[model samples]
Target: MRAEVDRFRRGAALAALLGEWSTGPGPLYRKLADALSRVAEEGALEVGERLPSERELARSLAVSRSTVVAAYDELRARDVLDRRRGSGTRVNGRNRGPRGDGRVRGGQGTAIFQRLIDGPGPAISLACAADEAAVEVGQVMREVVAKDLDELLSEPGYHPHGLPALRQAIAERYTRFGLPTTADEVLVTTGAHQALGLLSQVYLRPGATVVTESPSWSPCLDIFREAGVSLVAVPLDEEGIDPNGLAAALAEHEPALLYVMPSFHNPAGVLMSSARRRAVAELASRHGVAVVEDNAYAGQNLSPTASLPAPLGAYAEAGSETLTLESFKGIWGGLRIGWIRGPVGIIERCARRKALADLGSPVFEQAVAARLVPRMEEIGERQVVSRRQQCALLERLLADRLAGWTWRRPDGGSSLWVRLPDGASADVFAQLALRHGVEVIPGSTMDPSGAHDDHLRIPFARPRREVEELVDRLALAWTELRRHGPREETPIRPIV
Candidate 1:
């Protein structure tokens, strides 16, 4: 009797969450299936939580028993809800749905990267924020071949510390940016991702705590997690991370390192203000926390005349800050060139790790990057014009077609961090959009606490036509959701 009563309560709660679901344009069964799937993916229904029987749910929802049965059948077909003759129906905790390919959708993070790696399939992907190489890249590559290919090929090409010319060029770029640096302080890696991995290997130990911004770059969080460190997140606002929150987290966690993306933060697209940057540096210094400043998106300011703040490293205590830079945002992601700037000791340590990892980044790409470093501002100007136009188009399209969707105009990044309509889940909407031939990044993948699940990261870095198609597909998904009317509110579950 007690077990039966518990099942009744679960059914009642689920019915409440599914309010107005039948009002959607789809057949009653499909509408119910979609609602249940959304609630399950959003975690309202616990994994393995037993659902009410078809008869009981039909009674609770005031629907026909056949309607309830059909909904359950649809859910089972999608592998979202599982049923057994003796065990009754339950939410599938594993929830591994078919991707139409042979692979199963894994965790949110894995699903995101797998989709990126697999390309868009029939869908237009707005997942990757990177852009194609600038014309200058081709020009510079040709120059490098004509000028230096023979000497480079004759050499062993193993300089785990990086080629001298590229290192000096990177160092010079930093010095010009007001963070006095030398070639000895820079360690080149395959890309900024590897630079971060090298730092994780060199500084972090298993079970250490690292403080970072909430809703940070997903891949950065992944790297830190892979190193086995627990992450403590601080909230961010328009000006960037809240210094007060940073101070509190530092005091509470006493973390070994602080990882930040101050300039054109990924997903969020907000630049850290100069004053906040100073405050961040001071707090890290007072706490003796080593800071990793990710400046990968620094020079790609959308406003050509905008005077951005100096890097956080400029204000940080000497030997206390490590800065990572890459060619992806400025020149091209295909070059796969990146470097780290820090105290010589840290550089030497990262260099040793880099040597063990891949021996070294390709000499030819480094040669091209060396020449391109000086031309970034010129190339960046061109990117800014194109990106600004794309952003305007995206904004207009979303306004015209998907009215309730909104985002802050990014200061200068490739993507917009868009918030969906209230009560709508991006995880569910992303699946719907994918089916409609577009791919988007859900905010939950980037957020450590999963608090941003209602948001989506829409990249505007693609060409104009692709941007139009992406927005059109997203609009179709949004219309399907909005046709269902507002979701009925459910009582908030207590946090465990």
Candidate 2:
């Protein structure tokens, strides 16, 4: 029995060492630091938990004690890791982050975000860089769009949410995704941002808790902090949230809400396993914790997709806890519209919350959404058509030019999560892109605050020719950055 216990401890210790990445290449010191960072980000090495000593870890991993010491120093300098004379290296607690504002910024933090993507125009300046909304919108919906135009023609058009028909359409999509939903269960909002804003408003009190993923979508943090919500971020692995850590946070914080992008999560470009999703459902239900499911990017699935059984509302009883499912941009980000799906009782409660915030989402846009929401599959199909083309082009470019960088072929998402060797920083690489007039979203932008400086999310959802041009520009940018290094800090910060 003692032998078995010792073996289990060693095994657990080794697993913690692996974390989200491997430290097999480069100098022993760099590899060790890389391994420690991965573990810390994933919450395996908790803030107060002591690390094994340099001699102890060296003996296990078969490395020199001096190498371990160098790795520890690297982490400590970054402020994400630390050590004590009596204790050992430990993670910086998940709560150590700055307060945020209210509202969602585009998660891809780039100064190029504002410059009209298509340069000076002839007829008009087109934002070609931004994915265009679905062109195949149904004629039936066009009529409704026209009707909405006539109905609200006399009034100021912008409503925080959208039209009721659109809200119902969004509700139906949730039904298809595994939830038994109704129109009233849905709230029409400005877009995913508005729906998320409602979530921050309804559940959080100042300093109340909200658990999320590391390498998360950053722009969304605005409202989380404004509501004075303290975050508990679990770093994401390819399989999704760290399950063991998630359970612990729930137990420790007994948080009021949890926000997630389980389906093809942003930046990571992958979906959570059904097992993890099911476990999350059970965890949220058992604790009576509300889950705000941000499906803002869910409908864009392009490969063999992963699906869950139901929204949290489907798993739990009415008035038990709450859930919110969002969908918007009509297959793109231009329109700025989305929905929040949950139990009508809870949604109606949020409606009161919504009314207090904004009388209602604009009447006409809501009408337009009513027409578009039901046609999601159609929009998805159109997107897939483009995705198939763009993906192949990217695959070819990567095969020919990016053989050095290893990447994951995401099953149902737009970006490729590449693992760059030798401890390179993607955020630095992004800043370098400016030297070449190209844009990139560094992994740091994906964190609650700017962290995870090593990864990048280069989207491949645009035209093949444009994407190819981007690939060439990226290569140049990377080379230039390698020569110049990352800028000290971002030159711009947009108010979300």
Candidate 3:
């Protein structure tokens, strides 16, 4: 029984390590063999780890048994793998020493990072939702250097609580949004991603439960999972997370934290109504659950005349809510600046964690971000118009080329939460799409429960020409998918 369990674990690890392996050039068997060899070379697998049987691996990879057999035979010929009658297949003993760290390394997220740092390949990616830097970033950066470079260089340059000016800027921005805040209430991090990580580290423990929207951002879910906390997903609707569902989750699970994106949800792209925000605040407060409202998309209002509600912190009790803000959506992803607004105690705790993590974010970047914070409204106006135009173009292209696929028009955010046609599987379609030179995120990546297999999150923030090309490639992939019926479901993978 123990051996069987180990076999299952190895099979799952290999499946994740070989992500999109079939998309590369070569015959299917060759690609399989090469992917296996690559992972072995990278020390991703143990030197003597036993591999799953060919039949089992074939089922996991959604390929025929013959394909697996051929690949294994090739590996055996090259002495990279060994197979015996009853012992199954194992990595060759002569390869290298065992990796004794005992850490589970490879996953879809790692695969995405590898691709990103290696530079863009042949595929047109709709996986990431970030856009180019705001035009004012360069000018502001120059001004910051010209004015503060001398003094900033003279200092030791370590600020765990963040630069005083940037903290004040962030606090003032929150105050302007109707949530009165002080500089002491803010802790800056590398980005919203790091902010979430610090909160997870400070507030959660292993085996603790966290309640979040079902289709929340994948990276956020990854952070909480890494912190060793269990997740309970509450469903979201057109008006954001269902209040009744949240109430039930809180009542039943007594979660340590409730994480939500109340402004413009990441994949769903729906803005929570003001009444819903109040209900969320009231329910969380009543249950004594610490709330983390991610307002990363707060200023991304695509509608010019829309009066967006204040952050959820404004509606919640004074010390119960912590809000996270970032420059990713309103400014640029490359800026890597974000802050947490909360009670002084919570801010201090998170700051301690931040100090342990990175000492501090780059002082130069924070200096520039401080100047840019005051100009967010000006920069966001241009972003709103560009995103609106791109969203419209994507909608028209989807309607024209891929009939029967449906999605609600997003109020804000850069991605559309699209439901595939009846009987379609997003996991399989995503694989097919990658083969056709375009990449998209399957809904399963965002859903912790793996229930939304038929949904896809398609980002429309790319250049106009790339968007058109992406649609054309998607049309081809969809046509091919229709010809060949959906296969067995693949493992859910993470994306940005």
Candidate 4:
């Protein structure tokens, strides 16, 4: 029986799915060219589906336009793409239909094989890094009343730039953090996700380059990819992205955006050192690159000996294009509140984009967040105790059961980026883990170039009991997988 091929309309999504499957020791364009051809041949990218513009794909793949251009040319030479004037480039043969529904359908070669997906049922998901809302969040929510609703509802409840009160609260928090921001410099968003998306939409043009740390937040990678921006990735060390590497990337790529998570990076969980922060700020300023400082985990330091650094914006000289994004999710996942603080002009631009996205985040959520911001430190105090306990438990269990796995102790973040024993693939381990009632995100999903196949990110911010039980199941899975060995056939499903 033959299954239908899955066509990729969005290059970023497809790129994420490919993971490090396409990565090898060779020229990047050749590797990219081979990857596309392999996927197309395997029926993942069905023939006749229009490919993303060279510039669009180049950005998402973190390669140059020339690299994408060369890859496309190689595909064209091989009759993989049909390039006729006015019709744009598309797969060479028949496609299922015009790509309208925004779904990525796959066949046999997808990372998700049918046997892997149709599991025993109800697997534990470690993919989500957010914890349950804190107890104080409920108290904050209770404070919002009919009178507040009436006041907000009176004016259509649409503040595209976010509610003035919430914006002021966010601005004040930054000022207190030493950034000295004004309310007008802040733009409230539904979440940091929306804030990042808005920035991508407003500032990024097709084929422009955006620099980010490798193994960054997976969702941020997708946002930039979908916006048709090239994502250039630089490797990170203990202190964060190496200054010399960043300098080289900046000099070569001249990126439009430099998205960094200096405080408690997702997956990696390393904070960028103060010295490195200054270097990055100066480099971005020198290269005219705009920076998006993702401080989502800034206040979630669970480490007993961790010290917080100043916001990256503090290092920015006057009028530099640096925007800091903050989310309440780290404090309370269900809060659904975030904001961006930057130059007034950037805020205005992002506000206009936000207006078109969802009008604005709920007025009630904004009001709740405003009430909660002042008490955030209180929430953090409790979260540290809870999260630290969970983190220690997971690490101990992994040490006992998965003897060869190693990870840097995070300063303070939700997840640990653990490296598997040599020759073990996170992609294969994740698939097998799913069948054993636990689901984990393979680290490769977080890389723009799909280069971290030997790594996995396990969130330690879950409930202590739940995490303990899940780790037990994960240990069992790992034992069984070791006995049977990693399956060579399972396809890597892109994490959306």
| Top lDDT model | 3
lDDT of 3 by residue, 286-381 (tens): 999988888788778788778778888889876575555565556788889888888888889999888988899999999998998887877777
lDDT of 2 by residue, 1-496 (tens): 2211221122223422342222233565676677666545654344555566766654434345676677777778777666766645655665333324211122232222233432442211111224655665445457866665666677676543345556667767777867767777777766777778777777889979988888776556656867877878877777778878788888999988888887667767667776677777788777778887665666666663534335545555455665765665436565556667776666776677777777776665566566676676666766766776776778779667654666677755666666655767654454345345554555654666456666666667767677777777777756655564432221122358
Q: What TM-score against the true fold does each predicted structure earn?
A: 0.79, 0.68, 0.89, 0.77
Q: Roughly what TM-score does model 1 have, to 2 decimal places? A: 0.79
Q: Given candidate 1, what's the lDDT at residue 145?
A: 90
Name the runs in model 2 displaced over 4 angstroms.
1-130, 138-141, 145-162, 304-309, 317-319, 449-451, 483-496
Q: Tell me each candidate's RMSD, in Å, in order.
A: 8.3, 12.8, 5.4, 10.1
lDDT tens per residue, model 1, 1-496: 2223343342433553442355435566677888888767766556777788877676445446777788888888788888977978978856633334433122335545655555656667665787787888888889989999999999899989999999999899879989888999888888888898889998899999999888888777878878778899899998888899999999999998899998889878889999999999999999999988887887678887887788788998764655555545556878888889888888898898888888999999999888888877777777788888888888898889887888999998888889987857775566556556766566766776666878888887777888888888888777865674222322222357
lDDT of 3 at 276: 95
Instruction: Report lDDT per candidate.
Output: 0.77, 0.61, 0.79, 0.76
TM-score of 2: 0.68
Residue 212 in model 2: shift from native, Å? 0.5
C-alpha RMSD in Å of predicted model 2 compared with the true structure: 12.8
Q: Say which prediction, candidate 3 or candidate 4, comes out ahead on TM-score.
A: 3
Please estimate how well model 3 matches the true structure, expressed as its whole-model Cα lDDT: 0.79
**lDDT tens readout by residue for model 4, 248-270:** 99999989999999998887889
